[model samples]
Target: MVAREKLNQLKEKFGGAVQRADMPCNERLFVFVEASALKAVCQYLFRDLDARYVISIGMDDRPFSGKFMVAHDFAFDQDHLLCSVLTHLPADNPKVDSISDVVPAANWAEREIRDLVGIEPVGHRYLKRLVLPDGWPDGVHPLRKDFAWNQVPEGYDDTREFKFDEPPEGCTVVPFGPFHPTLDEPAHFRLYIEGEMVRGCEYRGFMVHRGIEKLAESVLTYNEIPMMAERICGICGCVHNVAYAQAVESAAAIKPPPRAEYIRTIMLEIERLHSHLLWVGLACHIVGFDTLFMQSWRIREPLMWIAEKISGNRKTYALCVIGGVRWDITAEVKGELRKVLDKLESEWTPVVAAVSKDKNIQKRTRGIGVADRALVKNAGLVGPVARSAGVNMDCRRDHPYAAYDRLDFDVITENGCDVWSRVLVRAKEVFESIKIIRQCLEKMEDGPLQLTIKDELPVGRIGLSSVEAPRGESHHFVITGENNRPRRWRVRAPTYQNLQAIPAMIKDQQLADMTISLGSIDPCFSCTDRMETIDLKSGATKVWTQEELLKLTRTKKT
Candidate 1:
């Protein structure tokens, strides 16, 4: 009913522009609008109706529909509705009005659409290549149906270099990474510094683009993608695994058993526990407080062990299938999980007490790397980043996927809107994750682990899923297709949006604060780089083919 109400509101304002609409369920709404009206409808939803901008997706639909498609997703959190606005463009020259001006959060997503799918976002200023390499040939969008997944453009030029922006007057440019000690992945940030204060930055990342989405659409099957999805981010693999599975299930109108939902929730929370603990430890380590860092990690070890006991791996759980989960929490594993959680809560309470009052840690983080409520809203930052700024949004509570609707837990919030606030928020959330897992253990009922599918999934159906990862909301968009794999699968990790706010967050801060400031978002560069290769000795560079890489991996194992 809420979805219908929102749809009615859109239809009332722009009758003919809203070409068609679908309400897959009470929680989801899909509206197909005229290509000309895409920006206006998005502006109305985002500015007037106050929907939260989620992500934008570009699709090459020429083979099936003889048209290109672009979709912009938004969330009506309080209304518990996820809505998508889609438009079809002419196949020959696919282009649509850009919504970046109105919805500032869509800036990178729009650029990504242009880079991967060749859908031009007309009137978009500052359109540089976002996802593709600097040397990638133009007019060769790999996401198109005709483009082979393994095909390299004929004019591929690895020797080409990226062009960065000029530094502000009186500011000196300083390169931060691609290999900084604080960063675990490869992301390069060129910071403009005036004395000790940071003026602005230019970020050039995606050094290891995995091309997982292309692989899913072109190669992997429906059930097989869950395994591959887990590798999207080393830290939040299960989050992706579950989110991908849920997206497919949603498109097909299939629901897993109640027990499976609980299992998913439990695994997700277990992941939260380890992730929060790891973040807190790393945050302390970044601030030069190794005592707390060591203590936090020592307390976190058992959670990993318990996770390994429940599933097979500590990090990549490989837990979800299309309709349900791969692993169930038996009574033995459930009891062990409870004991681990109990110990974690007890150990974490004292650390929180100590950190809350520690003047040194407070001095370092307080009022540093600040992202106020306005930045959170404008940039579409989610999870702890948004909550730290006093924006009361948690996908588990707001969107209510899996067993979240049946469970009870608090959505933590803080007003500091700084690195200190984020530390406190994540530290305190550990107890909440403990609470959620306990509830799952007690309330979980005995049922089948998966739903049985009798026939092929209906084609051309679109599904969107948002799972609250420890760092932020992990969103997945799936369009069902004929070959038992997705026609298109787009993953918008929280980092994709959260990292965009980095330049703003670190701006005007001391140069020394950059590491902690960037760390506060808990950015997973791999997730953003979802769209890799190499050479050695002779200094001759050659992009390794998948076959060569697999052979190397096999040789190493042998």
Candidate 2:
């Protein structure tokens, strides 16, 4: 169940290098390797074992282990094995050989760990600031346990600007955001353009980094973190809530009742339904198709109302607790949910058919923002983005958290590997979500909504959970501690990996199509920054009219 043969193979090859190996659950394997052998162990898992890199977490554990701790996570989607390769470095010399060269998706996580935990990623290509702001002072390392949550370092400069690399020869520099019509949050993009074609792009983002993880580890109690995790992403609040609860449950080895598991599954699917519909509408609006945008929104409004009716709030359901769910699907609510699913299916079928045949839609999307399987493997992309590229990996089917094991549904995939395929995948998945919810309603039995724990949860245990968010996989890693709080909590959002592939997708693309290319990912950032005006050196710097964008898109071929 824990891939015993593979674990033994690793032991056979790297016998002494594997300091400790554990099977925490049937699906998870935790291997603590010698600090010097970290790279080789990761390479074996990522390249030889064909495991997909999930995330890397850095923690200051000098107090407990007398050393710094780093965790490199990988997902063997085919074998359903989720592995964490952890290693500890000496407290005085807290450094580890970089694995980013072997696992490209580990690039940002390594840099982010360096930025927050003060553990240097030696040999990392871009070891500069990632999660921290440019104005943040050097050596401050806010995530270190010694630093207070609200503490501000001395000599901090709020007005400091990021310095990007020089643009290529014959290419003009075009700044995309800090203020752009398409991005909601304050992320700046430096686009090097030569005659309307994008040569390369450099991103300086994380303006939306709210320190949610810090809050959970420092101040929040065991039962309270679920509520805080929900605020991490506005669109996927329930996904965060559920992931956090499950991580705790996994660490404490707490099993909720069958009915609670079913409720969690139902809520997740409901969230997916609304999220996919919202994405369809937004993608349509990005392509200058206002009619479809309005239509999609019209069809989705009822879902928002239904969510509020059941969860007491529309977005932050706050439905998940440590051991189980806070709310259950009552008989009346179940009946209403079925009716809504029926109407959603009825309305979405015609829209999908019309969009599938629309020449304008196809031209705008067919060849744009393509992420091939090779790029996906390198960047460790997940969810629909990976599925669109013919990479068959779904956390629901592979990882099977919540009530997914008891349910039956297709893991929707597309071979097209383009924006068009991504759209189609989400559209078809709406029907699958409806199916999942219907099954939950039919097979779920009556039981308590939550479990009562007689004692405090065991401390110093590791917990990991990955939920299939509408955008992609949302993963949470937890380390339990004393005083009713987790000592360390790390969250890896889907955008953490998917956003890395943007430069690859947008390379050699027409400048006019940049908005749609970015929109295809459905970034959690706010609606584009209004740039009705721009500096004179760059002419015609205004959000394009619908007609112009569509015409520009059609002129370009795949």
Candidate 3:
């Protein structure tokens, strides 16, 4: 009914511009609008309706619809609805009005669409190459259906380099990474510093773009993607696994059994516990508080062990299938899990108390890397980053899935809007995760682990899923197609949005605080770089040296 009301509101305002709409359920709304009106509809939803911008998706639908498709997803958090405004573009010249001017959060996404899908965002002010490598040939869109998964486009200029923007007047450029002591993965940030203060920054990441989405749409089947999806992030792999399964289920109107839902809830919270503890430890280490770093990891180890016991792997649980989960919480595992939670809470409480009162840590982080409510709104920051700024948005609470609706817990928030605030939020959230897991263990009922799919999934139905990763919201978009694969599967990790705010967050801050400032959002470059490489040979694995790897990357040849 609420969805219908919103649909009616759109129809009333836009009339014929709102060509058609689909209300798959009370929680999901899909509106097809004229390509010309896409920008206005997005503005109305984002500004007037106060919908939170999630992500934008570009699809090459020429084989099926003979037209390209673009979708901009927004979350009406208060209404518990996720709405996507989609429009068709002419296949020959796929272009859509750029909404980045009005929706500042869509800047990188629009650029990425232009880069990978070759769908130009008309009137976009800064259309730099966001996802593609410098050596990748221009005008060869890899995501297009015509592009094969293994095809290497000719004319890849290995000697080509990225053209970075010039620094502001009187600022000295300092290169932070492609490799740095603080970074866990390869991300280059050219910091523009003026008198020990950061004036601005230019980020050149996606060094590990793996082409996983292309594989999903072209090569992988429905169930195979879950395994590959888990690899999206080393830490949050299970989050992607569950999110992908949920997306497919959502698009096909297939619900996982209740017991499987509870299992998913448990696994997700388990992931949260480990991720938060790991992040808190790393945050401390970044700020020179090695004591808490070691202590936090000490408390986190048991959770990983329990996860392995429950799902067989330490990190990638391989837990989800299309309709349900692959793992279950048996009685013995449940009892062990409860004991682990009890010990974890007992050990973690004092650490949090000490850290809260530690003046040294506070002094270092209190005002470092501030992302206020305005930054959150414009950048579409999520999870602890948004929560720290007093933005009450959580996918678990706002857009419930799995057994989160059945489980009751607090959404921890902080008003500091800085690195210190993020610390407090993630610290406090550990307790909430423990509470959620315990509730799942208690309330989980006996039922089938998977639903029986008697027929192939219906084609061309869109699915969107948002799972709250420890760092932020992990969103996935899916369009079911023939050959048991998705027509287009787009994953937007939390880091994709959170990392965009780094320039603003670090601006005007002390140059020395850059590492902790970057660490505060718990940036995961692996999640953001969702591409991959493959080896088809049956011989022993051949490890490439740095020189060899560089040559391979530049050439893009087998």
Candidate 3 collision pairs: 210-531, 210-532, 211-531, 211-532
lDDT of 1 at 537: 22
Error of 1 at 485 (Å): 0.3
Candidate 2 local accuracy as lDDT? 0.86
What lDDT does each candidate get?
Answer: 0.92, 0.86, 0.93
Model 1 scores worst on lDDT over the 10 consecutive residues at: 533-542
lDDT of 1 by residue, 425-514 (tens): 999999899889888889999999988888999998999999999999999999999789999999999999999999999999999999
Residue 407, candidate 2: Cα error in Å is 0.9
User: What is the C-alpha local distance difference test score of candidate 3?
Assistant: 0.93
What CA RMSD would candidate 3 show? 4.2
Summed over model 2, clashes come to 4
Residue 471 in candidate 3, Cα distance off native in Å? 0.8
Supply every candidate's count of residue pairs whose N, Cα or C atoms clash at under 3 angstroms: 1, 4, 4
Which residue pairs collide in model 1, if any? Answer: 211-531
Q: Which stretches of candidate 1 lie over 4 Å from their true place?
A: 532-558
